[model samples]
Target: MEKKVQQYYRLKQKQKDIEKELAELRQDILNYCSEQETNETEIGRYKVKLVVQNRKEYDDAKLYETLSDPEVWRLLSKSDPAKVASLTKLNVISEDKIMHTYALKTVTLLQVDKK
Candidate 1:
């Protein structure tokens, strides 16, 4: 069991290292694209596209107030039933789920001596 835990930790560390390398390579590609002023390029059947996504952040309290309003929800339910249903269901279900009842289990290699 100890050996398995050690292996799991080693594998997790290796995965992180690979992920870091992958991110660096992706950044390098983006840098090259920016230097060339190209949005998309094709190389040996591989197509790379640089897309910029913009988003607006609203105050959660205000947003929730708007969403929870009966009139606003009714309008949304008519125009966008799926979105309204998803938001309403998530709100109700999350409220019913108690966070303390959940247990998150993990294995760690670090040893602590208790006096």
Candidate 2:
């Protein structure tokens, strides 16, 4: 195996072990915070928090039906930006036409480099 592959495999294994230990530590912290009647607590330099985030998922069919606007549907409906970019690269769609697309937001991904 190449050096990068070996490094990735080692880090991936460490990540799994860290995740397991993290879950256990998370539970312990949560239990302590709950018993103390608070959603946040300070431990050493880390201000641990059990934050509740609100996330909304809209259904495409129902949203389009109620709104009846093509522009609204484009923004609200679920889509894959990578697919949009792929189609654009293949000359299937114009970049100017997708300005209203909410899924056209910038994104970045991390992966192992190809040898």
TM-score winner among the candidates?
A: 1
In candidate 2, position 32 carries an lDDT of 80
Candidate 2 residue 115 C-alpha distance from true site, Å: 45
Please list the C-alpha lDDT of all candidates, in the order they appear. 0.55, 0.57
Tens-digit lDDT string for candidate 2 (1-115): 6999999999999999999997787677767877998766666666666665432233445434554656644653554445545655775555565544333223222121222
Q: Candidate 2: where is the Cα deviation over 4 Å?
A: 43-46, 79-115
Q: After superposition, how far is residue 2 of candidate 1 from its true place, in Å?
A: 1.3
Error of 2 at 21 (Å): 2.2
Candidate 1 global TM-score: 0.52
For each candidate in turn, give its C-alpha RMSD to the true structure in angstroms. Answer: 16.2, 11.7
- State model 1's lDDT: 0.55
> Which ten-residue region of model 2 has the weakest summed lDDT?
104-113
The local lDDT score (0 to 100) that residue 29 gets in candidate 1 is 76
